[model samples]
Target: MSALTLAAPAPPASAPPPRQLRWLLRLHRPALYAWTGLVVVLGALLLWLGGPLTDASEAAWKQYNACGMAACTYDQDAILLYKDVARYTGSAVLALPFLVAAWAGASLIGRELETGTAQLAWTQGVTPTRWLVAKLALPAALVTAGTSLLALLHHLAWSAGRGRVDNTEPWYSIETLYAGGPVLVALALAGLAAGALLGLLLRRSLAALIGSALVTGVLWIGTFLTLPHLWPAVTRVSSLRDGPSGSGITVAEGLLTADGDRLAIPRYCGSSIDPACGSLFDRLDAVSFYRDYHPRSHSGPLLLVATGILLAVAVLLTVVAFRVLRHRTADRKGAAV
Candidate 1:
């Protein structure tokens, strides 16, 4: 019997190491450049005309701080800048960069699948995990940087305006735009997860974009409008001016207005007026008057809870997506041989 010589089977091809996939993330720079440019321009404009911004906030906050007949006063133009221009505009600015980040995140994997490029990458020794990580790394960094920059800008603008207040207006201080910490992180993560989910389900760049937009819109509306007030309390102060001590507070015989008008509420809770009302109007005399009004807001707690839920969902979905995409890629490669 002749000695049998058996040929060994060829080893399977391995994917490129994770590092090359990292190198691929450099493609996100172009979009970052454009967004940074816009932020710079907007910042310059706001700084130059912060006077008007401060004036506008003054007017609004003063109105919010007004007691029955005793209303606070401030420059209307400055109040406008702080309330209308700075706050809203800063939010809008922060939103733009995140929007771009969402589009990029959604496009990363989805575009490859849609265009058949992912298949090519797989064949070229790039594993699904490496490809996904590579694609996401740079964009995530850019988004974080962008958000930080926007937050800083908002802080400076708000702080400057805060200095002009006389400490009597309820809504005129800098603590109003307080949604920074984990809330922003949650929002960014939610956007990324939304993009990833779209990419996986749709497998088309345009479809992923649409999906991201829809998800983000729903999140914004749902968290801000519907969820916060779901549990309504007896007293709702929904404005910056509803703070503890920032309006005309008096301790006298009656609720005295600046014009010497007296006012009273039907029911007095204690020796002091309800903190929800003001401190100045707890007198024995009976009269009806709206205390200096500082409308309050409750957007913070609602946002914090929503942010936590979204972040958890994002993490779970991302893990599922990774497993599915990796499995699908491996299966396809096996069949192609």
Candidate 2:
């Protein structure tokens, strides 16, 4: 009783720290909904493509093939539907990176910075460093998870149609291959990083949005130009009669000399089975036609190498984003502390 009387009232318990993540979720709720909706729609379409659509298209192809050079009756509607769905979905999947970059730059970082929301947060419980971390870490995880899911589903859907639907894209087809692999996931991550960095640098929403998308576009173009060269192309030599034999992505098809010199095909010269072509080949000392190509077996290596390059660029951009944030915050006179 005496101790209780003598003791000073304990200091009021400090208010519980604000949940930064709760605010983050609240702030980005619309984006979250939009992303969820997009994933759901795409996922549903992919499942349909892999199952019913594929089956229907395959059946139609069988009927058409069986009729052979005669007036044929088949489910032409199913085939056209399959093609349209596949084309649209594949295009959507491939376009995701640039779309993500645009949104990330315009809404995620640029708007926050441009509107003073980020600076306001820095004065509260959240430091500039912590704010940046919160902004990037969650979005990065979500983007990676979502993009990876789409890619896996796409690959499976594409695989289901292979050998079944004659019109299905080959494995090396750029849109099909990129949309249906881990490379898409890596590219998405890089786009996120690019958007964040560009938003921070420009500090203007529209400018950052355009800049990010352009950067991502450039990244993709570079990957396209660099992919085939990343892995060594196998040399498939066929006698000049067969006209350059390998089956997957063709890098180069040219005449090979007896001394092993690779020569470009002269104008109008193709298969040596052509009398004119054979005559020209014999005169040029061409002993065979050699095709430098990446077969189906090389798909794994090409995907892995391209993915690695994109990931490296993403990491570099992320580090720079953090550094830039720190420097900017440091100049704000302890506002971030």
Candidate 3:
């Protein structure tokens, strides 16, 4: 009699662990969709600005320039229209950092920690460090990519209108400088870091949101104030009668006297040619009208310096966030024991 020993079915194999990135994507699907939609819409707007809007604006500008103020009637409306479009587009690009900060604070880390999901995640085979890395890295990569693309598009659009559109902003204008270069990417990343750090420190979604916004605003303002000083300014000395020349970012312009004193031009000296101004200039022995400016060539160096500073700050914030998290984790383990 053969002993019928039924072979036990092989134990079911455990499913492979879900990837960190996949889990992050699944958790923040709404953010992903929102970001995708924003990029698409902005991209379309930039294309239009570079293409049809640019053409229309240029045509209108030509017509206006050709017609004397006395003869201007046909395309006056187009000038205003172009200005409106440019302003709106610039505003949208400039607002990206604020949006990134808000999302990072309210949704990315704050909400997760606030609701205890971050702790839950750690229990599911994810370490706190890995969780924070996933949170920061994914958003940072997306922000850098999106902002970089938009900046390139913006630069193209702005370049297309440079010589043709009379009303277009100069290259060194603050909005143009920030929104149409890699600086925007740096700002976005900085905002993300600031938000994350605040979220971790505050541990409450609303508080994190407000604190992050304030910190981001301060960073932006500080950058704006410090930018002109990032690179050496070019000094031009021209005849007091002729005022300074060369189109660049003027840092300070005043009278350079023969005695080497830098003094503001007198109010009475409205024009260099004014008799009263000429008298004052002669009396003061003003040698020349001096202008300190950041030449167009300095643009690259300034941008690089500012971007490096912002990145350094972001890295600092990230390191502090990790330290805070590790401390909190250790405290919890100590209590449990």
Candidate 4:
């Protein structure tokens, strides 16, 4: 019977496929919950800002104003929520990355290291490289998705509000700055990268949190101060209108030109070329002066530089994290022997 059993073929041991370390990486619930709550709150706040709670007041919006001999008719209508709220809301949303950075950076990798749980995790089939990659992947995905959704919502809500009301509000004024596609994405990624680097560098939960806050604060101040200087060509001036002599002297009565080239007619009013040689008519070609003028005030170039710098920092810190993980794992293994 034993000989017969020995003659039977042994069962082949099956090799396991490579485990996806990503499955093990998960957001800490408290942090995830807080971030989700913040997102919901921001969305609700934006909706409230865009919605009309009350119509324009009859008292504040009079049908006509009695001022001297000039009877100014209040032909203007009620203000729309979009014009009043959109740009400001979008700008406020732009600031969300700071909060996201502070919260995310604080907890990112530091929490794992602090709890000693990551050490246990490394002993599994997962390599440190796979584990680190997994740690970064999920949070990066979440931040990207959140930022995209925010941008889309802003675009839809603001587009609906365009031209409905006077967009002269400070909120509306900043929309162009906040609404650029690349700027928004870069801001989000910058926050994430900053947070990840902080977490990796500190290796302590609270330290990571504080470090993120400090970095975010510094970035905000720096961006506010310097970004405008990086791309200045975007600012525009109104164009002057040329017309017949009947309306020729009307200064503010005319409309701005299509390309926004406000003329220096005031300076040319009494110049040598004027109809009256005594009346100087030096028509300064403002367009010619401004045409070749290239300004680098917009935030894009600075943002790119900042992004590259932060990305490099994040990579370096990540490398350090990998080394720390590997070294710790080797130490543990050597001790076990």
lDDT order of candidates, top first:
2, 3, 1, 4
lDDT of 3 by residue, 1-337 (tens): 2345666554322321457446865899899899979988998898888788888888988777788866665576777777887788888998999889988887898988999988887766677887888788878999999999999998898899899889989998876888998789998899999899888988888988888888899989999999999999988888867767657788888888778899888876744687878888888888788889987799999999999999999899889989999899889989999
Model 3 stretches astray by more than 4 angstroms = 1-16, 19-21, 268-270
lDDT of each: 0.56, 0.89, 0.85, 0.53
Q: Model 4 — TM-score against the truth?
A: 0.57
lDDT of 1 by residue, 83-150 (tens): 55655555665475257535754556678688887767666667677677766667666666765565
If scored against the real structure, what TM-score would every candidate get? 0.60, 0.92, 0.91, 0.57
**Candidate 2 lDDT:** 0.89
Q: Which candidate gets the maximum lDDT versus the true structure? A: 2
- Cα-lDDT of candidate 3: 0.85
lDDT of 4 by residue, 19-76 (tens): 5353454446566677677667767755554444112312213333333467665534
Better of 1 and 2 by TM-score: 2
Q: Which is the winner by lDDT between candidate 3 and candidate 4?
A: 3
Candidate closest to the true structure, highest TM-score: 2
In model 3, what lDDT does residue 321 have? Answer: 89
Model 1 misses residue 42 by how many Å? 5.1
Q: In model 1, what lDDT does residue 242 have?
A: 30
What is residue 55's positional error in candidate 4, in angstroms? 8.8
